[model samples]
Target: MRYGSVCSGIEAASKAWEPIGWKPAWFSEIEPFPSAVLAQHWPEVSNLGDMTKIADAVRAGDVEAPDVLVGGTPCQAFSIAGLREGLSDDRGQLTLSYVELANAIDAKRRERGETEAIIVWENVPGVLSSKDNAFGCFLAGLAGESSELQPAGGKWTHAGCVSGPERVIAWRVLDAQFFGVAQQRRRVFVVASARKGFDPAEILFEQDVGSGSTEANNVGVERRSSTVDNCTLYRFRRTDSYIDDGVSSTLSARDYKDRRELVVMADNRVRTLTPLEYERLQGFPDGHTLIQYGEKLADDAPRYKAIGNSMAVPVMRWIGERIAAALPAEKLSGDYGGSKTPPDQRDLWRTPPALFASLNDEFCFQLDAAAAPHNALCRKFITADQNTLETLWADYLNVPGYVWLNPPYSDITPFVKKASAESRNQIGTVMLVPADTSVGWFREAIETASEVRFITAGRLAFINPVTGKPVSGNNKGSMLIIWHPYPRTHCHFATVERDELMTFGAKLLARREAA
Candidate 1:
């Protein structure tokens, strides 16, 4: 199979697919260092330079379209690290360019009566939340329906959208560690094919296939790291589990400057990975991105940037192998069972220290504490073991004081209802729950609570009870629902973003603390 790769940082797609007899026909890149890396290795392949011109180049006969189009576009636009602008930012518009180019390729294939090319794309999980259901529209576009995107240019034109029965599209969040990489990198991979009898879901979603499969029901297996014989294997972060086995944390370009990001033991001595080690973690050849421009490029920052940005070679290879086998193979599309709707981001179970400190008060009663004490402010606590649901309604509905309620994630309606009722009784209560707008309880809290503060610090990282460490992080946004018994003069209910939430919560907590 041949490939035309976009946003081709060091051409990870080429390295990944090469072993399976896949070849790169062209690469799209602009960065100097990564472009040099591509020139050093896949020098024969044409460097297309810019992804925005792919469709035009193909149409103008300046470049030949390949059987496969693969790319991990710039993730910053949708990354939580930046303001998730989705298609609004100029960088975000590149995603639209990708879709447009693929549409153009499909259009050409139709004109020539040729098989439509396969499309594989990758991005951070934040894309799942960007621009209010943008992923849903992305799914629609791949299925040959209109994407309903704005700016007119990003729209899926009927001519570009394929309408036949042969099309199949699927997406899933896959971890790199599961695919034989020794790093805990989780990314969203989307696969689509406009060919008949080919199910992209079957290729991308199936688990424990072929020989020597390590697949299991254990999710902890992904986090499990094994120590190398004489080398110091390391895990970073006080919040992460201290495992006997050595598994490396996810590598980011920014980790070079952050000691906490790359804490490691080499031969029992603490050190960070050399550029070569970083390359190997991503399944790249040693010095693939480095040593390209000789001493001029010897600096590690560019190497780290290139390596971190590239896709995991082994993960892509696994996907490529499946694509190869499934080309002529038969599999039912829907039987594989993947979600068309992106999964909701996981919620942080424990509130962060700063957050807890910012919201604490005197005489606070925790209505829904678990066996594990997650909140420090709760002087009087009700545990799940004590049938807290029954207790909340019958025993303590009118109990006065600053009440902190981090109720059970499931079945929050009754608790929300109780809190709403008790607010009328002049009991001040604050509840933390997922900001899932679809749920009835979420709506109930918003409608009934005196004020709702949407946490804009993105997501909270919760502490793990079993490991006594912090879990990596949860993507699900949280909301603080406040029900003050005394009516406020400013407004009945106001929604505040991160800064406002932090500022307001901190002032209140500080006042109580000072007193």
Candidate 2:
């Protein structure tokens, strides 16, 4: 397949898809460093520079109408770290331009009696919940909807599919760590096709067959030096530090100078990740960003930024393969059997330490009912191996302190029923779950719980069980379901700011540590 990429930071799509017989029609990157890197590597391919002009250029036949249109438009406006001006921001406007480019490519192809180009887009998961409905607008434009599509339950899920007048669209939030990268980088990927009988879901969703081991299809699996003390200390702090086990956090474009965002502690020394390590972490070859620009060697700052901004090569490679498998003539028939299953349903999203600390202080949580050894927030906890659902909570929490439960997203009904039952037996419980008010279980919680706290500051960035890093840009809003030992006559409802809780919790933990 020949593809055109826009906002092509270092052309990660080209690098990932090239090995599988896919070719690049052209690239649209304006950054000096990344543009130079593209020229140095693939000099023959033209750099279209400004993406806003690509639609006009393609319409004028100045550029090839590729078989596929792939791009990860500027996400800052939609990123939680940014001002989040959404479509009002100039950068966020590029998302619309991307749709125009896709339409232009398909228009040119249609004139030639060819099939419509497949559209692949990637962005921070924050886009799904943008206040301006940025994702809904983009999807509407791509799907040819007469009006903007609203997410069910007023929030987008991690995965879903939609069919519209123009195209069939499927989207899912994928984590780089699952694709063989060590970083806990979670980003939303959307695939759309206008072809008749084509199901975009086939390209993005995978069947849960086999042993569920990703080893067989691991990509760019590079070996790194063992941890200095048998455990790598991954720390992220606002003013204080907390240690956790696992891989690195998401590498950001500003990570080069943002020491507090991610810190590596080894052998009693603290330091920042090197540029070369950034490249490797993104599944690029060592020194992939250390390219020759005009005369002098490229500086470390630009290299760090470029690599950090790029997508994880392995994850992109997997997507490319899936797309290829769904191409014309080679498309597989019959249901994949797992397309509708939420991709993150089984993931162990540990509660953020600061938030947990604050809640623990308020409730004196003595038992972590749903936890693994690596992500347990309390000294006393039950593991998956123990079958928390099958086992009695009274057996674990003999004393009668509050219980904290962040159950698997796959199914929260059983846990809710259990919590309600436990509460009736004089056990208090606090459960963190998606605020999906439409569900029966959610209504049940409202009726049975003493209080329901809707986390309104923002979507809580839950910690990844494997990486020990907080996965930001959570797609849905969260809420705390509190059940007191004695049921209240009426349930109290309140809104809490996650940032405030986190800050207060962090300071409390810091004072405790100092003491």
Q: Model 2: per-residue lDDT, tens digit, 1-515? A: 67899999898898799788787878999999999999989996789899999898677655777878998999898998877889999999999999898888878666544568889999999999999999999899999998889999999898999988888999988877766555768899999989766688877766764322143333345433322233463746445765453557788888767644344454555566678767766888777788887688898888878887889887789888887877644322221111111244334667888999899889988889988787788888899889887777776675466899987776677888888888887888999987667666788777789999988745676665555666553434688999998757988999998788899999989998999
Whole-model Cα lDDT of every candidate shown, in order: 0.65, 0.78
lDDT for 242 (candidate 2): 50
CA RMSD of each candidate after superposition = 26.2, 27.0
Residues 358-436 of candidate 1: C-alpha lDDT, one tens digit per residue: 6663334444333235544455566655755455432543445557776655456777877777677677777777665
Predicted structure 2, TM vs. truth = 0.60
Global fold similarity of model 1 (TM-score): 0.57
